[model samples]
Target: MSISIIRLGIDFGLVVLIWMIQLIVYPSFLHYTTTNLAGWHRKYTPLIGYIVGPLMLGQLGIAIYQVSTDFTFYHSLSILIIAAIWIITFLQFVPIHNNISKGRVSESMLMSLVRKNWSRTILWTLIFLSSAVQFF
Candidate 1:
């Protein structure tokens, strides 16, 4: 019921989701042929967006609320990190995914996805850990 608890839950969800994406989902793109990967990416992006969109919005919204209400160090840090994630997602990842959807699949691009995702994996994990610390 507490805001901290809700924030922790959202952060935990992101941590798990990003790990799955980094370790399993993105890497699996390498196994697909170009045409198949493009076709699958078209479907996959929208479906995955359903799951990712809400969680990310929830996380960002809660972070903003927390900082605006309390203005503590932890809340500020969380909001900053969330902002970074959003920026990276839109500025970097979105274009790549858009290209992939348009049949621009390449081994280098797939590998870059896996490589670039480590930044998010670490950031989400850090957010979760910080949330856990605040919760406990």
Candidate 2:
């Protein structure tokens, strides 16, 4: 199969995943009590990581390969956006998830999670759209 097709599939998976996270998963945290949320978060993070980790790695690996092989505008932009998403995930979301798992969650924090996640949602959507345009 073509690399562009593979890249589009990965990007599509991520865009769907991010929308689910943004619209459904994160917001649902607000409904739980602090203790329940913490307990659930502990389990949820690892479970979700299983799905997220491979997709992210595939996306990143494909992005790197595309850029290194072709060095086109689309590949370069895709890699830069992927890099930003990685930075945001580690630098911003990881600490928040850690705190939540440790029972340090507050309403504000939950709200912040939903709020901050918009950036990722938009970025992933853009990646998918760009991939689609390139593929089609």
Candidate 3:
């Protein structure tokens, strides 16, 4: 019923959307292109990647800001979790993708990045859910 509660709900929804994109939509999109469109790798999909990747990062910002701006008496846990996730995203995920964008990396590198970064994803998912509890 309050602003913080609304923000938390929106944040949770966006976080779930992100997980769906990463785990479902992206892989399916790539897989479909690999089969349905020959030469997708040469230009088309990479261009889409350039756009979609940044969009995902933007969504992350949305979630982070939503969580950060919501103030509650016990907000420290939410703040700490969002801050940690943001740091991990900057420190761990960004560099690997930077390499990819520069042609200095490979899919294997990104997969490696994801594997290493899985904990952050799970942690943030938990953070989103836990933050939602403040509404109750």
The residue ranges of model 2 lying beyond 4 angstroms of the native Cα positions read: none
Q: Which pairs clash in the backbone of model 1?
A: none
Alpha carbon lDDT at 54, candidate 3: 56
**Which residue runs of candidate 1 sit more than 4 Å off their true CA positions?**
none
Off by over 4 Å in 3: 25-73
The residue-level lDDT of candidate 3 at 131 comes to 61
Candidate 3 residue-wise lDDT at 52: 46
**What's each prediction's clash count?**
0, 0, 0
lDDT of 3 by residue, 20-89 (tens): 6467643443343333423433354467557545544554565556556764544555556666766876
TM-score attained by model 1? 0.98
Q: Indicate the worst ten consecutive residues by lDDT in candidate 1.
A: 127-136
lDDT by residue for model 2 (44-135), tens = 99999999999999999999999999999989999999999999999999999999999998999999999999999999999999999985
Q: What is the TM-score of each candidate against the true structure?
A: 0.98, 0.99, 0.59
When superposed on Cα atoms, how far off is each prediction in RMSD?
Answer: 0.6, 0.5, 5.6
As a TM-score, model 3 comes out at 0.59
